[model samples]
Target: MKNRLKVLRAERDWTQAQLASALDVSRQTINAIEKGKFDPSLPLAFKAARLFKMSIEDIFQDEVSEEI
Candidate 1:
């Protein structure tokens, strides 16, 4: 999976720690997600979408979808 998490956080001037706090995750988790080294759980993805007022599809993209 790929995500625009870093861009979204940058747009809001939010640090990884800040994003982690808001998402109830660790800063490393945020970093991992931003770097595409980790994928968030469905619940976490929904929480992030709710926080950003975006759909999960808006934030996270399925790499397989791009292949089509």
Candidate 2:
């Protein structure tokens, strides 16, 4: 999965720690999500969508894979 988390955070002038605090997660968790190292749970995703006032698709995207 690919996400616009970093861009969104940057647009709001929020640090990873600040975002983590808003989402009730660890700073490392926010970093991992921004780096695409982790996928958020459904509840977490919903929380993010609500926080940003964006739909899930607006924030996260499914990257096409070449593997058939």
| Best model number under TM-score | 1
Residue pairs with backbone overlap in model 2: none
Per-residue lDDT, model 1, residue 62, is 98
Question: Cα RMSD (Å) between model 1 and the true structure?
Answer: 0.4
How well is each residue in 36-68 modelled by candidate 2, as lDDT tens digits?
999999899999999999999899887874233
What's the lDDT for residue 12 in model 2? 100
lDDT, residue 20, candidate 2: 100
The best candidate in terms of lDDT? 1
Backbone clashes in model 1, listed as residue pairs: none
